[model samples]
Target: MTRTLEWNVHLDLSEENGTTKAEAVLDTGSEKLMGHGVARCNPQDVDIPTIGDELAASRAMKDVAGQLMRAADREMEAVGAGPTKGPLGKPYAWTDVAG
Candidate 1:
């Protein structure tokens, strides 16, 4: 059997003098979730300074990815798929990624 799940999250980031916002959507079909982050600068607040849109967006997406991973892990546990552990045995030279 196949199953599908959907998730959505919104995050608000508050810095010393400014606030940023972001949203993420997760769909099982693509095997990956999509995230978008956004930030804005308060012109009147010099202390906050302005981080361009690109930087704010990137930061939001990164945070989304982290949240997705955690959600996946929790779901795995709930389903009794067994604890997530490293590979069965000690690593060998060939086990390295380049190998």
Candidate 2:
């Protein structure tokens, strides 16, 4: 069966002392997930707020992706499908974050 569904994502960003931080929120009718990330500008590098925003936002989205994956893993387990083992290859595994 085909179904139509919608989920909303909201992102919040802040910068201070050459550090940019982001929080990504995914809201579903039944649940909400939160993800966070930060980017630090080098002391000698140019302080470009836009670049920092981009980096931090990307990282936050990545965090959300991992969370979604973990959620899927859990559901699959509940159905006796066993570990997700899709990318992380372990139950509720997390994708590595960029450094």
Which is the leading candidate under TM-score?
Answer: 2
**Alpha-carbon shift of residue 4 in model 1 (angstroms):** 14
Clashing pairs in 1: none
* Tens-digit lDDT string for candidate 2 (1-99): 999999999999999999999999999879988999899999999999999999999999899989998798688899999554446543332455432
| lDDT of predicted model 1 | 0.59
Cα lDDT, model 2, residue 51: 95
Clashes of each: 0, 0
- Model 1 quality (TM-score): 0.37
lDDT of 2: 0.89
RMSD in angstroms between candidate 2 and the native structure over all alpha carbons: 6.6
Q: What TM-score, over all chains together, does every model reach?
A: 0.37, 0.80
Across 8-51, the per-residue lDDT of candidate 1 in tens digits comes to 54443444435565555555555556576666665765544346
Provide the clash count, candidate 1.
Answer: 0
Each candidate: what lDDT? 0.59, 0.89
The deviation in Å at residue 90 for candidate 1 is 14
